[model samples]
Target: SLALGPSGAWSRCAPAAATRRRSDSDAVGRQAGMFPETMSVFGNRWAAALLVAAFLETTRFTDFQTQLGAPPSLLAERLQTFCAIGVLSSSPAERSGSERSTYLLTDKGRALFPVLVAALQWAQQWFRAPEGPAIALTHRGCGAGFTGELACDRCTELLAGAQISVVAR
Candidate 1:
């Protein structure tokens, strides 16, 4: 909500719902506790940029640097973070003589394929772009366009936030 202050400048107000917790069980609080560790792998400033580039086949350190236009130090830091977490595998670019190393996506890193796709799908739908999306993904096997739905395996239906339930399992 917006409010006009005494000086006449509009001040934004937080909605009441924003201040209220959804349940007494601290679901959000519990999630917040896990976020730092989660973000340590997924929440850095250039994380999406770097991971998207990697998903698109950028392998060499120099190539990632060039494509991302990120400073080498920051890029190296992100690469190190991924390496430490087992998301990427690095090998000497020159097996016997080269000083450079090549980075490859591990199965862990490759698992983010759907995540990247869902991110793009969400942004394209909810955010307006002046120049349209950067890229589109197509299913290679049957050439079907993606809908980015988190479908349920049991019912084979699209799932939304309210459709979910949490158990301490």
Candidate 2:
């Protein structure tokens, strides 16, 4: 487990194994963890933008390219990757029997909504917004500005850094 310190840095709270030594097997074990794999999904410069665009209902390939200004090859590659991972489903376009296809987010992709919201909230706090936030979100249900919150699923209690722990099994 890791704990956030006063300086806002995370440090391992669990005691280290005294006799453990680094090895190739240890590196392989770490690679198999979900954290690295998840990061790889969003590590590219345009990945988050592309995913967010999909969330916003931009389906056509041309629209995605126009909105993101992404290179054609890279955009196609990313879309294919998303499809291969079950994050998105591609289907024939419904417009006038066009040959183009549309991409839609699957359940697995929709599950990332909160993660994106959390990321936007974090950016608002840590980054400069001299002209105000680049994107202002409002919740349709409440008719109020959205402020992303993290809460416990079981207890419905609000959660903070100190209350959370990452346990390695």
Candidate 3:
């Protein structure tokens, strides 16, 4: 097994031999023994958009539909996928009875916040907007604008791609 060195910055784990894609595959690859890498849980672009909405506490079906302008079918599929993967929990909106269901992020889902934050940071840095970022997150305790920092979990130091090294199993 390839060790992550506590930082998990191993870009070399990318599916180097992956070629033209096919349909309905867990991953778009034929690389042998490609498991246990940085697999994208929500591979769909819309999935990320929906996850951002969920992080902001929007859980109702209608809310997701309205906010995302996604078709009912696609949205339903993604939501079901998230629930099936234990990333989101679905429950009745009403304790007694309700026609609608509500979605909540599970602990596993909440763990994706760091990944989301890092992606947002990268996007903000590269994709500049004329009016600045659409959202600016502030640290509650520190009271300062916050952005994700890529750090080494073992050494507790900031990381760059150049500082990372990947090993093959």
Candidate 4:
């Protein structure tokens, strides 16, 4: 017979050493490449939105500037820079009268959304809400509200600040 701890009683339990080792290796690999090289590209709201808008749908230069309330020249400059970086593909619209160019996210830009989500979640935790959350996530299956809380992927527990460490070389 085995003694149960204060948490609860369980049947037989076996520690899986091999599985744990593999998971640890995977975590290390991710951490090694965690920080991005082109932080300047995502430093402003318009740049971030350029990526987000592309992710949401195909957008024209004028429409993007209108949506973000940014100047047309600035929007054009950022779009050109993003295209240069291979984050977005920009080309003239097919319509003959269309003066605006369309922007679409490449695979690389789509991948940055999760990082943006994490940043938003962190902001929500530390910043005061004037009204409420800017956006809310709902679970499609269960209809439960999902606040983007950073948690340990393995333990399914919220991570403490001290537990997080970053290394760059």
Candidate 5:
């Protein structure tokens, strides 16, 4: 087991091999719609942090902590987990006077942004909203608000949630 400083946190310094195994499992779990188990590595706070980070022009550890309202260590741990998952790319800042590293969304991360947006739309439709959505999405072609509804390609009609079926193996 690798040691993470002197904290004696067993989970903090998992063996590299074990970490790889866990990452694989998490990927599978995410595909299976069992993201709760997968998300245990980063948890809700970190997930929120990642979502917040995606909105920014530049993502850094400090920016993540500030946006998520999380502690420094927690943010660091979450960012590391996200990088391991191939969702976020991290690189040392190129310019001088930059102490912290910068993060960017990988292609996979950008694809997941729509999923997050859909989830938020569902939440806003079903749950009580204290305030409106932070950002509004619009269709550039029509300059109209983009509705988060999915429609049948053939029928051109709104698809009901129950109409869709998933056959899990």
Candidate 6:
């Protein structure tokens, strides 16, 4: 079983793994995995919403607050974090002196498009939408409504969970 340790690291704490106490190095590794880190970022609703909104072309600080209903302080914090991590870039919205800045997703952030697409596909499959989808996307290239599919880069074959494997580098 996986559980969050008292120190805030996720530990595999069932069976034999639980019997042995974790060392400092192991504890550090627990927090270093990319999957956990990515989850940590996306798990914050404000952060996730901000990224999605950036993809949808919402750039201003005020627009993010209005769209996500995030408090000013919290929104600022999340935006700062994103900027620090190089996921988003901020620039003055105008040449004239103004406090406002436009936030745009950086190339690093744009690389996350596949993950976002997968998540949207999963949500559409599993979540109920009595009022229909809040947002429907259209593909400019295809000139039709967009539906994402995961595929292997080499073979271009459609992929599913069973077809994928996680291997450490």
Per-candidate clashes, comma-separated: 0, 0, 0, 0, 0, 0
Query: Can you write out model 3's per-residue Cα lDDT over 128-149, one digit (the tens) per residue?
Result: 5555665566677877777678
Per-residue lDDT tens digits of candidate 6, residues 86-107?
A: 6889998876889799899899
User: What local lDDT does model 3 show for residue 11?
Assistant: 26
Write one digit per residue (lDDT tens) for candidate 4, span 89-161: 8778899987767788778777776776676567556763555554454556788766556688898889878
Task: Enumerate residue pairs that collide in model 4.
Answer: none
The worst-scoring run of ten residues by lDDT in candidate 2 lies at 9-18
Screening candidate 3 with a backbone cut-off below 3 angstroms (N, C-alpha, C), the clashing residue pairs are none
Reference-based lDDT, residue 33, model 3: 35
* Residue pairs with clashing backbones, model 6: none
Alpha carbon deviation, residue 18, candidate 3 (Å): 28
Select the stronger candidate by lDDT from 1 and 4.
1
Query: What are the runs in model 6 whose C-alpha is more than 4 Å off?
Result: 1-37
- Model 4: per-residue Cα lDDT at residue 89: 85
Per-residue accuracy of model 2 over 22-81 as CA lDDT, tens digit each: 222223235666674465456555667778778768899999877666667777877876
Better of 1 and 5 by TM-score: 1
Clashing pairs in 1: none
List per-prediction Cα lDDT, in the order shown.
0.64, 0.66, 0.65, 0.56, 0.55, 0.63
Off by over 4 Å in 4: 1-37, 94-99, 138-145, 149-161
**In lDDT terms, which candidate is top?**
2
